[model samples]
Target: MNIKKGLVLGISLITLFFTTPYTPADDKREEKGEEKKVYVLDDIVVTAPAIISGNEVNRLGSQVTHVTMEQIQDLNAMDLTSALRRVPGVVISRHNQVGSFGGGEGGAIFIRGKGSSRPGAEIQTLIDGIPKFVSVWTHPIMDALNVDIVDTIDIYKGAQPVLFGNMAFGAVDVQTKRMKDTGFYTGIKSGYGSNKTHMASVEHGGKTERFDYYLLGGYRSSDGHRVNADGELQDLFLHMGYDFTAKWGMDLTLIYTDNWADDPGPIDLSYPSDGRFNNDDFFMVATISNNYERAKGYVKFYSDKGDIDWVNQEGTPGYDTLTDYKNYGIRARETITPWQKGELMMGIDLDYIRGKARFLHPVDGNSAFPEETFRIFSPYASLSHTFGSLDNIYFIPSIGVRHLNHTEFDSETAPQAGIILGIKETRLHASYGKGINYPGIYAKVQDNLWMPGDNRWSELEAENLDHFEAGVEHRFSSKLIVDLTWFYDRGEDRIVTSPPPPFPPILTNIGEYKNRGIEGSITAIPISGLSLFGGFTYLDSAPDDLPYAPEWTFSAGFNYSPVDNFQISMDTQYVDDQYVTSRARMRNTVNTDEVDSYFLVNGKISYDFRLTGCDADWQVFLAAENITDTDYEQKKGYPMPDLGFMIGFIAEFN
Candidate 1:
């Protein structure tokens, strides 16, 4: 079918299917006649960077999706990465090799088919309001670890609240569980999955009259399916809170993560596509946060660092490398209510980041690519006003500016405006925002440092984007909630690496490019004990296609609990044609064809039980991924494996 025809038919089919009701699952219940009772919608979706507590499923918002703790646990997910797969419009790429012990190339994620291929640094990850960077390009430090201590994960598919940090090309916020009021509590869990994958974790937390604390430790290992691809991971998490009084409080958190395994480098399936390599990365972070409700303000200070060791490069010793990074920041924010239905939020944020890389001979270590450091000072604010319940109208306007001291780059500003109109059970919204991205260490090193004739380094401007979106959400009943959104984005002056010429263009400082696109998603739970979620995205870039960005992508799934404590779930996604690399000359070549679309399946079952002195539960989970055993690559030439499974248990003590 032609592109236009396909698009029309796709929308018609989806709309028709949703309009027709299905049999309600007996397990579905209503709260005060509200259909969205199973999950609280308002508490679920994070409207802005400011942290708000409540049930997300019931939260009234636009272009947002939330995954609750119960939803994560019921699936018996192997990691936080997999736990987000069920979220509509979100695409998660996983390593397919059975023996592949470490999480590597094939593992990644994309939101609305944007920023997925770029190093993960562009995608913002917030842990309890603190901005987090995952080893520059890879997944978060906690991606491979267990989620035993997590409370919930909220995804804002577009520009989010101004306080979280201006880095989110596509926003993701992760919130960890906190210590309860109970005197003391502890829990432990163990599980076994396919490929000899075993996992275990211990978590405990308690609250004293003046202080509260929580700690979690976990370990996971596997004898991977690939010949040399086996590895292990260890994780540690700690959180503590102190209440000086009813209006003053402080919270602190520390995290340590480590992963090591044979790389199992990419395969050239057409040639000799099998080889073993080594991959190891370790990360750590420390943060402290203080809040004063009476003063209507808060502040935070934190630092993050990491190192990577890649044993096998395509063919060079300089290919072997270790990198270090340090980030320090301080932010102060406050909220004020000038009128009954109007409020203002303002903040000042300052951050300094520095890093260095050491590589072998072929890396040209003698070049002028010295260690680098940069600082950003940003101050921003927003004013929002809400009408009465009858009108249910909300209008918000905001702006943020970043000043970069190094590279002699001038400052840049981003502005945003959004409005929401609620009419009984239906709500409509429209928003426009801007985003800016500065060059990272890798960009500077490859472009300006090595290129002999490229004098445009200092002249390169930070990439910028103008985003616009409009959508509507309707509540047909308590059990049936649906949302549809349309977005158009224009990218301007995007820094891109130019190809090498007679003098070999520098690696870091590239020229520029542009991109534009449309995207949307649908989330619904038509019946009790069952939920159906799906989403599709369409994108057209200036260069025909963007790397790792499928022109069209989608996911559909359902979850059911036939009996108490026993649940079953399945989900699948279709990613249309996508480019593995950014080279325009080879964009349509057969080499990139390996990363075609495929289907994946997951399932599980858990039983609740108790022993004297122990509140325990046993869950047996079986996840059959790539059920057809189709050999496909989510990343170029990186052959992913087929058909795999896992099983696990949990016990709590007082």
Candidate 2:
């Protein structure tokens, strides 16, 4: 670890020394009205500073979906699941009603048919470029990711070793809001919906000459659609930034979430009692950044801690479980234009995690909790070159590699490359990459205890994936744009559960799978104040019947403002039939069968008004989800709510 750190530091220093100095001549030209143009990364699209760029998105080497704050507001999204479902190639499954406990433990997001029932295994979630996942289960808590506090979300649908290390089948980077102007602003929002659900939030931000800060606090509660399926959640987010110089700055972020829910056991179960669980989580990150004319860099340190408690009320004397987890990490990255038409990026990541799970007996004493610790180190680099245009066409190519070292497993390397060709308003791109996912703590422990005879624990290795993709993007006119992409992924030595006759299931790395899909999207502004968008996806997988791997998914939406200060929007989504297995199916207790395909319609309307004699704006809105009241089951025995409505008002003061 020390050696790796030393090497990173040495390289940083050398790059710093070789950086081209800012020249007075450049400043003079700018002062004389010759503004320097920003060089955006090829094919990348972003509304804020990020590791990737619009050029990168355009290059089509990798498939990316960029969601902006405006879009979130338009949808009136409450959480990650709602916002992400609108993206092509992305599918989110939730159990029970909207805010029920099953929504957290049973919910999952699949990107190009890659995600598993487990959380953090298939996709990695990041907050400001720092990973956020429970150390104990190694999965993301979707409820904890409040959409209100986020400014933008960048979704990468394939391997991204250059910017993110392991578990990058699908990666999401969430950037929070920050104050930019030297003035104070505040906002308040509140709403109510079906099942006695209610939500409220307050936010404030300000910026001064050298400092800026943002704060938000919110709460949501619901009496779920099902019996004994109630839940409540509270969250807080804070961000502060300070500028030390014109080219250097530092930022600090803190987030906390408290959630409690009651889980109604599976529908087929005859149990009369309800199981309950609670989670209290906290996260903090501090970063220092440098932004020069031709270079950018940042160093960050982060910590996450969570406490979980669960009570199973299936029997007269229920059992209780408690789990505690802690994780800390450091991340550093630098990007520099070392020469004409060329850019280089390098980064390093280090993480340490510890967790313990305990079972408490009511009459007897509590059992000893097995505590475990893990450490990981990763270093990576990427280089890209842009070839000058020929006949008004431009070409760019890039290559990257990442090496990961795990304390308990063999080290591995991931490599990736891509090329993009662009002419006028059209771009064609292709890319190939390798990715890896290590065994989660739970998988590791289960292998050790249940598979001791086979000693599979000692022989367990990281899962590997190879990804290939090609795509094209075009802007037919100022009013219309379209994107189409095709992707293929192959996995080997995947960790899966094996249930043998008369024996409990065990974790083993003996699974192989394949997924191939085509995703397409189009956006059009047919007239002033009117916007239309639609997306569709087609997926084919090995085992051809993998549950929740929908063969077809489609969505279409439009936003229109017929008059000033008023706006209306509507959207519809359709999903094709897919196989699914429920507790009843597994136990042969009932035949729930495959999940039936369904279609849904949603709509919203809002109007803005000014506060006379005050620097403030007030808005009132009404929104409805599942307006069609479609009967659907993303998860069996967990029917979704039928036609939920919310009425809310927002006041923004400047």
Candidate 3:
């Protein structure tokens, strides 16, 4: 059905569900000598809390943003791309739609105009502090991680702290849910919208005196808005924990995703006869944590595995490529209160990875590729001191360093320092840090395959980055808060793909890039039931060739509830003109870059209610995205979908 019909049908269903007649169970209860109880809609309204607590935000030494589960639900976000775009200084690129596969080529996220042309390269992604990406290629598959089980997301815009290692130019940390109370609960959410898209999810969680468990499974499929673009995804996540004693505990997490997509190619080209991509990814992590009066620590072991296959049918003889990768790592960290108002932390990390790539010829069935293995060890420490308050003012300073040892490269050291000053309702903070990015296995193996006797591989060195940031936050009153931050990053010896005369393309460290930007945001509660939020970013890059780096971006939104049980929310985002390389031009002839810009508006309405005889709280919501039906492209030649609508209901029971 078309979007218009789907929206009308969805609204009709919701109204019918709310107003349908039913036998009053309270009457039967009264007949049985029990008191009749009535529930008012006012009591059912739920107001979401702030994304991050004030205390938590103040304790961090770096620039950070948090997205809570409540906010995710309010936005009707089904994936990371949808949810992360709301954050300042973040931009996301998707080939066509969610669940589509483009290898390490589909989606890219840029932060402060710095991101790898390759996916997941510029930013590090972690789940519960464990890295989540293909170790061989050093990139993440957006669809491989499920959003249904997430409880919160923490985003670090620039160089991360010492606790995280390896690629930390920017970081995204995903935390899953854990049972809070000792009771069983189950929920199901389903929705349908334009482009023949549909989604369904089931979740259950329970806790006992000594143990707790949570599980979620979901599936999404869509016949995309473009021709030959169809995708499907199935994901499952499980989390369990056991408390052996008051001070010791163990927990385990497992995730699996199977995704498939058919590439439609560029809009300017004819749809291929057969173009498919498939991936089966798995991740598991187990941890043991201890809590003592003076110290706390955890030891964790994690494993990630991925199997992918891609086929191109446009060739004379359709060929397919297959990749298999496995990565396992162990991490340990301890935090100790060394003295009054002082703390120290230390950690160690070890990782091992193996990967193999195969190219299959349709006629010969000959598949062979090199298998590579690598190991890494890193140790880090940090110290912090909090001085006694003077005249109601507080001061804190911290420093940290990490030493990395790699099997194939020279050792490297990274250092960071920061300070925070607070007085009354205002805070001032500044920090400086250094980060490094090592070459991935793909580059090493590809060098061996294409250039057997070249010394270019050995000459490659780890890229380095220096970050500096300062910010101030003020709470004008109980209902208003404002924040402003400035950041500058300089990168040296950056890796770039170079195709020199009479030679194949090779990875080399031959470029330098820099970015300086400022971001500001405000949150205000004008009245009891109304909230307002808005943010803007101004970015400047040294080079003019940076693709997809917009100079100006702004977002504004508000939530209001005129009635007790009904809420209305609206948000708008503006992206200034940015450069993008044309996908179609590259394939057909010489590559060309183009500039594009767009504005998007979205709105939602929700009603909360509880049936008189039911023990569940229900919320029905309708959300419209891109209401203006603006025609734009995040990636040149790949036009994003026009106006879309989704109507869904959420139910919770205990």
Candidate 3, position 360, lDDT: 74
Q: Give the candidate number with the greatest TM-score.
A: 3
Query: Relative to the unseen true structure, what is the C-alpha lDDT of residue 219 in candidate 1, on a scale of 0 to 100?
Result: 66
Tens-digit lDDT track of model 3 for 1-654: 012334323433443343222322121100101111211113223454322322123233686777766667777776777777767788777665656465333555667776644522767888888887776667777777667767777778878648677788888888887775666655567788788887777666666788887777777778887886778777777788898998899999998888878766767775443467788888999999988878888999999988777776554255887778898989999989999888898999998877888777778665456778878799999888887583468888999998988887767898888888879778788888787777777667667654444537656777778999899988787677788999999987666656655465556777677889998888777777777778888989876556666899888777788888898887778888886641210111222455478898888899988998776668888988899999987766677889999888876655
Return the TM-score for each candidate structure: 0.80, 0.87, 0.88
Model 2, 1-654: lDDT tens digits are 002223323433443343232212111100101122222222222112111112236232576677766677677776777877777777787654444243233555668777663523768888888887777667776766767677767788887766788777779888887776666666678889888888777776666788887777777778887776677767778889899998899999998877777765557765544477677788899999898978888899999888777676454355777778888889999889999878888899998877888777677656644878888899998888888773478898988899999888889999989998889878888998888887767655555543444435555688888999998988787566777888999988776665655365545577777889898887766667777788898999886766667899998887788888888878788988876642111221222357889999988899989866654578999999899999887766667778999899987666
lDDT of 1 by residue, 1-654 (tens): 012323323433443333212221121111110122332333323111111111231122235566656666655665666676545555565553222222334444556545543432345666655665533333343343335546766676654435444555666766776654535555567777667877777666666677877767666667776644565655667777777876667777776656555545456444332223233222233333343432366677767665544443554444455555566677777766777766677787776666666555465543334557767777777776667563354443333333333334667777666777767777777776666666555555555444467635566666566667777777676445556667766655655545545454433333233444455444554445555555556655554545555667666666666666665666666767676543231112222433677665555555556555433334455556656676666666556555776666665544
Q: Give the TM-score of candidate 3.
A: 0.88
- What are the per-model numbers of colliding residue pairs? 37, 17, 0
Model 3, position 226, has a per-residue lDDT of 87
Off-target runs (Cα >4 Å) in candidate 2 are 1-60, 96-105, 117-120, 267-274, 313-317, 361-368, 389-391, 447-454, 497-507, 581-593
The Cα local distance difference test for each model comes to 0.54, 0.71, 0.72
What's the residue-level lDDT of 373 in candidate 2?
82
